[model samples]
Target: MPESTYPRTALQRGGVPVPPLALGSWNTWDRMSKDEAVALIRRATELDAGFFDIAYYNMGPHAENSRTDILFGEALRASGVDRDGITLCGKLWLWDWPNQGFRQQLVESLGRAGLERFDTVVVGDYGKVPDMPRLVAEVNALISEGLVDSWGINNWQIAHTTQALDEAETQGVVAPVVAQLKYGIARRSMAEGEAYGALFDAGVLTLQASDVFEGGILATGRQPERKVGADVGGIREQIAAIYPEVARVAAGFGVTPAALGIAFCLSNPATANVLFGASRLAQLEQNHAALELALAHGPEVRAALAGCWVDRDVRADGVW
Candidate 1:
């Protein structure tokens, strides 16, 4: 499964094909200048990474405007990548729910991307079971009108995702083809546990983000000194302790630490794609190298790395 050998895995979602690995513009956009962001995106396109995930609410609390998507749109136009060959995936944030607000948000996403329509629009993390019906309905409506080619959910539990799919079936509409979940060596429940089972049975595609364990915690042996809000910091510490072993395993395959982390996600049968966020052209080149590394590492190497999930904090409840 070397990056080059794989070419790019494509899955049919809502009768459209989407790239198996998507370029995510989250922290990458926040950290880079607008020009840097555009360069990184262009580099990804040059490498044939055909999907970009942009968020309208990426700028942080005080920022009323979403410059990230706009910058991405400008870059796409400037690069001259045929819109037909690329898939633009954006999110519908919590604040932009309900009819009018959601419609406005969708319009803004299109405006920002400088595209006529998105290939996939993920309505993210409803957080509760009750809210799913409305969100699914709204997303289906958007799909019906050709505003978006497909719909998806991000950061949701198995139960909530299943409920949403059930609702979609009841309405005779397609359920989400993708579920964007936090999945990596440091984060596994959503991919390995009951959540994966539910999604698999329902024929939903799995899209994993934060695959490098959020900035080298799992891949680079670096952990944050301060405890951020919630459960992530502790897990990072645990992952830091195991980084040497991870590096050793990666060395066995002659790949970088980041590639090893990504390969672990790709090894999962449920995973249809891995989402990577790159702030620079160099970073995009490094991350895209995973495709080649994957092909070089055979089943034995993949099984060995998969068996290396030994950190307890990562397995603890609330980590997912």
Candidate 2:
């Protein structure tokens, strides 16, 4: 809790400590060369930011047949970074839930990653409401089987997240310790709003800040021709329009907009860690400064970007 210390805490119920940032594998991670991936992995570990949120990316809108998981496995093996030295958080897509089954997804994802187990698995992205009891039981079964050490919810509604925790607690099973949501300078409502904030405040859950850059749009201060994550509240344009203000504020802090956006998320007391995607080693190195930024001028940065906290109506409904 010291000002100089980058917060490291157990993301799992009784698991090893994780750092303040996690590298995400979603869009551009698959495009990295093996050597680049290896170097990035090494540099991330060197920075003590070795936690990873890896996924197979072969379901729903992500069914582009990406080999990001496979590539990461290859890079890890070549990087020679000890597997035990890093924490891996995989994803279990609820897109095709009961039919595909968590077990099959777990097996296939681990196989793709060339790993035997994930330290944590996030059950995410469902079209409809899933059976809470069944989901909780399956996650518990995975824990017992040692396929995953722990589990958490991703983009889940506040009510459903509470139900999952209640079910697990009532059944005398392990419950989630973190809630991964789209949270950043532009997207703050879900993670900081009354419902989810209560969970974090009451010591029931910690926030995992994801999409801090809105898939590079917020970082670049310009919208790409390609698509991005859910435009919840139809506010992507509003978010884009506010980029100049973000850049202006970043200029005052003597940091890049991307670094300030990242630091803003890390500055929040409720955020246990922030997930960021970088395609280059330089980008990774630049982002490492965010920890110091968060430590030194966190409150001032938060207050500066107060105007960019748009999309207050956004909630964790498990859709995006």
Each prediction's TM-score versus the true structure:
0.84, 0.95
Can you write out model 2's per-residue Cα lDDT over 166-213, one digit (the tens) per residue? 999989999988899999999888888888888888878888998899
Off by more than 4 A, model 2: 1-5, 12-14, 315-320
| Most TM-score-accurate candidate | 2
Model 2 residue 242 lDDT?
90
Q: Tell me the tens digit of each residue's lDDT in model 1 across 105-201.
A: 7887787767778778887643334466677777877788888877777766666667777888888887887767667776665556654655555
RMSD of 1: 3.8
What are the C-alpha RMSDs, in order, of all predicted structures?
Answer: 3.8, 2.5
Local distance difference test scores for all models: 0.65, 0.84
> Please, what's the RMSD in Å of model 2?
2.5
| lDDT of model number 2 | 0.84
Regions of model 1 farther than 4 Å from truth? 1-7, 33-35, 58-66, 127-130, 224-234, 310-320
